[model samples]
Target: MAERPVTDRGEVGGASAAHASRGDAARRLWARPAIAVAAIYIAARLVTTVFVAVGAAISNSRTGGAETIGSLLMRWDGQWYWVVGVEGYPSELPLDAAGNVTQNAWAFLPVYPAITRAVSFLFAGQYPIAAIAVAVVAGYGASLALYHLLRERIDRSAALWAVAFFAAGPLAALFQMGYAESLFLLWLHLALLVLVRRRFGWLYLLIPLMGYTRPGILAFALLLALYGICRWFRRRVDPLPAVQIVHIVLLGLLAAAVGFSWPLIAGVVTGDPSAYMETELSWRRGWTGDHGGFVPFEGFIQASAIWFRVWGMPEAWGYVALGILVVALIALLVFEPHVRRLGVEIRLWSAIYLIYLLLVFFPQSSIFRLLMPLSPLYGALALPRSRAWRIGVLAVGLLGQWWWIDQMLVQGTTFWQIP
Candidate 1:
């Protein structure tokens, strides 16, 4: 029947060859070094999972806490997100017996909870599983983006090692939990990538989503403003069109406006324009003594004094110690050659974020999570002159990750811990 049409085998062989070529292309893409970073990320995650599971199982025997892996992953902030996912934000802010507003869903942003709620619907209402899946998947995307960013400045091997360090960092366990750190980090890295590429228009879109995710949107806006100013100066020498200058100014203002919108929304919902800042200060009302005022950064100094005195140190010395630590960390972050390697925009972001943390946030055990944006320093750790040193740093980081999980989640301790 096919005498007129060549044998069907010939057509079949052509189709097979086409399929083979496509397969080869996929293989080539997978072989890329950045993809290897993702592979390393998966391996580190598996190791952490095994450790957390074992820790939980052992702890369950003694404490009868939620030893199941799923339960353990749903600790701390994850619980708040779950509440928001199942029950939307409360119509009224909760008040304590003393009449002060208590912890409410408004304290947490809606982005992570909204995503978890959507995923839970797809899973037939397995909210915990849905949240964990979102975090894990987002963590992978973040690792890949990190590798690409590092690769822009360092070699392939170093980039891989850097990603490994980031995945095994002290608070890396947060990535495995049903928390929004991974989601926030994914957006953070993506925004940085756009900024590094000088894609300002993308930020006009990204700042709004970031505003929904965290109140730290203003930090990024400040970073972009400073960067734009520098670029504007450079362009003055070379010169650009009046329209171009106007576009840049308008975009900068718009980004900052969008960045502050979330706080304004929170204020509106609570029936007080200053509700956002007032609510943040409410957490510090639990301090031990006449520690300090309600002003920004005062909580940090006050807490330092209380923490050291609890350990039997004199309060005055404790204040001195806190002063030294702040100065040293600021010096290190500002002067570190590694920080310098990140280029002007990223450096600006880091500097602004640090200042924002100092001025607005309090000192807490959860400071590690607050500092998660600095994970790029892991790339510097990957660049020691000796290979053994790099391996040592990564090994220590993984060990710290395991220790953090064991202490924070497995032990089920509630004595002023931030888990």
Candidate 2:
């Protein structure tokens, strides 16, 4: 018999393939570099949480609103999630036909305190403690997920830094309480990891559920479209066709349809979505007299402007800075070194999806957590050379994001109330 080359049946190729698939997970778990990144942040969060708890215990007092960063974590969105997890929804005061309510779960309950309640059910003693614990743990897992995903594409060290930023970054405050971002980030990491596998069919199925969770999913779905186009472009001659555009369209439609139904239900009952909006907007606007509720685009702009002023800006100047950052991001992506490597068709699709977010949707609801997906979107196109640079940039970003959210939740009063 002639000598023959070993095939996959010889075990090497099979094992290599298996190794490629599971390599990042194993390495990320055991690797010293990754553990070091995760550990520093883990210890930092542990110390901060203990400090906050001890401070609360020693003072025998608590401050609500934006006075202290810790208190901001304890209240606002934290209070809302705690309420839902502990009490569930009460039918006695169902949301109005416009989908507005005393506790408007429709506006933001897709990512509620379900995890907190489930964890609490385990011990049933200190729910507040349990809720906080869930937030901290979920935040940690989210860091691991982010690290693992980046590690799959980049180096192990790069992934470690990415995970470290996720864990102990200024945005750490979000996890210190029962906020949606705490849970939302964990789910997002899993979703994005699945996306990297080029599993559009699975993405289409899962994105709708995510869409139901937060308004931010609208932006996320759009980013997915951009990534899809990028993938399709990179392999045109030897094209990879497993992923398709139909999933993006279907996911968009599903998100739009499901989210729209909530408002439509109110329109059916109250004559317009603005009816529920009138109340919510009025409260948020701090109106002593009759003022209208959020009218979608108009309301978003108006309320966000007022909020910018509250953040110590003169008149929505933060929006201008935000615009500049976005512009820089677009310039970087459209002109990445791989632009030619990615076919024109793929590039075009990516542009369409990303531009749609900038032009139509994001400004309409440019909340921080709503824009969290942008971090990944930016990360996708950003080919960072220096690990130190990546760490430094993300450190600044995390701080700025924390300040923005802190101002929104802790400092500012309510704006446009739903009717």
**Each model's lDDT:** 0.76, 0.55
In candidate 2, stretches whose alpha carbon ends up further than 4 angstroms from where it belongs are 1-29, 32-41, 50-72, 90-103, 224-235, 238-249, 261-283, 287-290, 293-296, 303-326, 336-370, 377-419
Clashing pairs in 1: none
Each candidate structure's TM-score, on Cα atoms with residue i matched to residue i, is: 0.86, 0.66
lDDT winner among the candidates? 1
Question: Cα RMSD (Å) per model?
Answer: 6.3, 10.5
Q: At residue 415, what lDDT does model 2 achieve?
A: 41
User: Taking the candidates one at a time, how many backbone clashes does each contain?
Assistant: 0, 25
Worst 10 residues of 1 by lDDT: 285-294
Supply candidate 1's per-residue lDDT for 51. 81
Candidate 2 lDDT, 1-419, residue by residue in tens: 23345553557877877988799777666666546655855775875555445444433443531244355455655676677677754333354455444435434453457767778877665566677788787777667766655655666555565565555554565667766675667766666766665555666655655655444555555565566566567766646554356665676566557655655555555555554344345344332232444344554455556567657886647778767876875675577653423233333434544554444331322344444543333334334567667767676755654454434543334442110
CA error at residue 190 for candidate 2, angstroms: 1.9
